[model samples]
Target chain A: MASLIDLANPTRFMRLSAVLLPWLAAAAAVLLVVGFYLAWFSAPPDYQQGETVRILYVHVPAAWLAMMFYSMMALSALGTLVWRHPLADVAQKAAAPIGACFALICLVTGALWGKPMWGTYWVWDARLTSMLVLLLIYLGIIALWRVLDEPSRAGRAVAILTLIGFVNVPIIKFSVDWWNTLHQPASVFRMGGSTLDPSMLWPLLILAAGFTLFALALHMVSMRAEIMRRRVRTLTILEAERLDRLAAQGAPA
Target chain B: MNDLIAPLGPHADYILGSYAAVAVVLVGLAASILRDHAAQKKALAALEERGAGRRSGRRAS
Candidate 1:
């Protein structure tokens, strides 16, 4: 925990990520390659959905990351609110767009999967609607960050909204069970048992884990980039101010 | 290549599409990040050099 805290400092974070990015990139490559190969070929087709079942390779993982990324943002929001950690604010802010990307992927892939399997491309089904709402919430957080100019001010405001919006997470989770939707009920992570065969299950599980680590890697890189951007902005502002002072001094009484 | 592509299901398009989409997004992301890092590094280095040059120029007087 102390080491983790130490690394949260931007310089440490940058160094650690520079060292770690290559490994993460390689792992992401290998896992994604193997996972897709197995998902498309080795996994037996759904006795029902047939080949379309392969879409789960992207859809399920994206959906998981969408929600997982939001949870991370909300947690960082909490840290920002409590401790006023600037890096936490930067992380939460940086993660919004990435989470939104995953959420968009989930929504698109879900629709593609549904069109052939559920007989419609768009439905106001519970799961679909809630996931759509998640995407909108991510957008709202991003817009909030953009609208506020002061970094600390924006952090405080988004932290408040994040706490308020945390309720939607559980709502998204339970919507599939609570309503009759064309969407299938929970399969992999649920009570009773995982309905999936192990051959099929292993690939989904690996891809899911890979997506998660991949998201973490992306978030770290993005946050590092954001820190650098903010540093540049500050330097630019300071340089302009110094020039203004020099010009005034040279202007004479 | 046929052996590699053969085991793919009848819907070769969908599998290929997913792979292509992921690759495009990931590559785009890598390129953008590297570009951003390089841009910022060069800008900061330029500013520092200019600042140092001004300081030395003043000291030479």
Candidate 2:
């Protein structure tokens, strides 16, 4: 916990991230390349889905990250409410847009996949509907932050909303199982065992890892940028106040 | 996508489109992050310099 606080300190974070940035960026690039290669070439085509199944390389990972991002936001939200870490607000605010982007990718790719598989571009199946609601939650967070000028207040408000919206996450997960849905049930991560064939599993796993790392790299960069933005805003405000005082002193003295 | 793309054989517009979209968004996002960082750094530097100038003038008096 102490280590985490030290890491979260803005100056420490900036220094640490500066040292680690190149490594993370390189790892993201290398993993993405290998993952894409396997996904495109090495992985066998699905007997049922064929090449369209290749879209899973991108779709599944994005879908996973979409959920992961929301969970992260919830945790950051909690951090904001409980610890009130200065970095938490920056993290929470920085995460919103990226989470929304991942959600959008998930939705768009799901639609594209659905069109060929289910003969429809859109469906209100419980799984799809819940995911849509999740996307909306992300958007609402972004919108809330945008509307509120006060960062801490916005963080508090978002934290409450995120905690409430977290109830939808499990619903999103179980929706397909609970209903006669077009979407498939859990295949990759399951209690008994993964149903995926070895030929396909390796590529998917690599892609998933690549996506996770990529998200982390992006999040760190974004958090750093947000912290800097706040610092600059503070400096600007203080400068303006100082100028105001100087102008007053000079007036008809 | 494998279903639709495999049939297209040598030409798969949908597969191509998906890749294009992903590349564009990722690059755009990277660029935006870099630009924001640069702008913030500049603003911070300027503020620090101005603050230093004010301090020096205060010492002068």
Candidate 3:
């Protein structure tokens, strides 16, 4: 059992990811196939929403992943600030674009689901608005990563931004319940278990699992790329220093 | 099979549109990530090769 600290080393992390990425991609593919079948062909249509309910299969999972990636970033932020884990900021940086994509998917799909159900696509509902804010925060963190050249400095900045932005996570979760909104309240995850029938609940859960695995695979690949990028940067600097030394000695650089 | 599933009726366009949007976005993101990974790996390998060749030449000299 490799500890988190052990995996902080880039070489170790890359080696572990090489073994894990293929399995994750395979599992994600299989789950998505089965889950989509269940969601599309096996499940019964909702009494009210009908075929439009199929949108839930993808939308809910995207929304969940959007929030999940943010939460993961928050944890990575702690790792960067407190533990000073070398890979923490790398993980954080890689996760941002993926999370942002998911957030965009969630918002767009929710709007699509809303148009017919609510008679209009645009609304200023609490859940919708707060979720939009979450997407913006994810984008902001990504922008911050690009603007700062120094990884250590960017890491600190992003970590603080992520922590501060975390205040919106709970707000997004509770916005539906705390305020009267067009968005539906908790049906699947509630105190007394899901109100959804097992027929529907099972497929949604499977779809969510597939989406989670897919996101994990993407994050792992992105992190590996980030590590390689840093290695290239280091090697470039070393070569530049060598050239500078040779020039100082009046040797052909 | 198609009849059993029942068409989305008036909302068919919206529902299908949503799924299409998701597939497009996810595919695009995956492609972008893979492209970056390949480019970075190529860069790292090239840098290492150059550095190694230089070190060997210096040793021979």
Candidate 4:
């Protein structure tokens, strides 16, 4: 088993991810299928919301993933700035769009769920607004990557931005508790214990796990592609330098 | 199909629409990543084929 430090090397990470991704993808697919089946057929509808409650299966997972990925990026940002881990910036860059997509899914699904239950598609509540802010922060980090042009420079700048944006995470989590919001407070992970019934909770848990594994698989592949892209950039620069030398020598004239 | 959806009540569209949207976003995300991976791999292979080797003398493959 390679140590964590050893896996930080891009080549090693690529080799390990290639071996693990297929198995990870297969397991995620299985779990998702089972979870969806149970959610649709086995779980009872909410007494108040009825069938609209079914949306919770997908909505909760997307919302969890959206926050989870941002937290991971914040850690990766720390690795880039503090430890200067080689693969840290690559991981952060690759995760941005993915996190943004999950956030978008969360918002859209929450709206769909909200309409039938809350009588409206949206509210300017703290939780929803903070979640939207998180998504915007992700988009900003992604744009920063493109604008910088140089990888190392972009990495440092985005790392700072990511750490600053992390302040919103706690606010998003505690927003409902601190304020009278339309969104419900934490049910599954409260300090007193989960208030959710086991029947519904099981499906939600399984689906969350499945989505997490799927996102990790996607992240790994994206990182591998980023590594290859950097390699291409290096080789192109080397090729250009060689042409410059050849021109200086006037050998090909 | 009707039998399956009938149990969802009058707001079946909302429920079904949520799931459908999730499916679309996830599928789109996966496709984009895979396409990017392929493109990068192809570019690296092409560059190496042109004798533009890495400074460390390591090939990506």
Instruction: Show how many residue pairs clash in every candidate, following the order shown.
Output: 0, 7, 0, 0
Off by over 4 Å in 3: A1-3, B1-6, B52-61
> Which ten residues in a row are the worst by lDDT in model 2 chain A?
A244-253
For every candidate structure, what is the RMSD over all alpha carbons to the true structure, in angstroms? 3.5, 3.3, 2.5, 2.4
lDDT of the candidates, in the order given: 0.79, 0.80, 0.90, 0.92
Q: What are the DockQ scores of the candidates, in order?
A: 0.32, 0.38, 0.64, 0.70
Calculate each model's fnat, 2 decimals: 0.22, 0.27, 0.82, 0.92
TM-score for chain B in model 3: 0.73
Which digits, one per residue and each the tens of the lDDT, describe model 4 over residues B1-61?
9998898899999999999999899899999999999999999888897778545433456
The best candidate by lDDT is 4
Candidate 3 residue lDDT tens string, A1-253: 2485875699888988999999999999999999999998899989988889999999999999999999999999999999888999999999999999999999999999999999888799999999999999999999999999888899999999999999999998999889999899989988999988899999999999999999999999999999998888877877888887778989886
Residue-level lDDT tens digits of model 1 in A116-227: 6776778998888899989899999989998988788889999999878878888888888888877888999899889999988999988987787777777877887788
Identify the leading candidate in terms of DockQ: 4
Q: Estimate each model's TM-score.
A: 0.88, 0.91, 0.95, 0.95
TM-score of 2: 0.91
| Steric clash pairs (candidate 2) | A50-B2, A51-B1, A51-B2, A52-B1, A52-B2, A52-B3, A53-B2
Residue A19 error, candidate 2, Å: 1.0
Model 4 ranges off by over 4 Å: A1-3, B54-61
Q: Candidate 1 vs. truth: CA RMSD?
A: 3.5
TM-score of chain A of 3: 0.97
Window of ten residues with lowest summed lDDT in model 2 chain B: B52-61
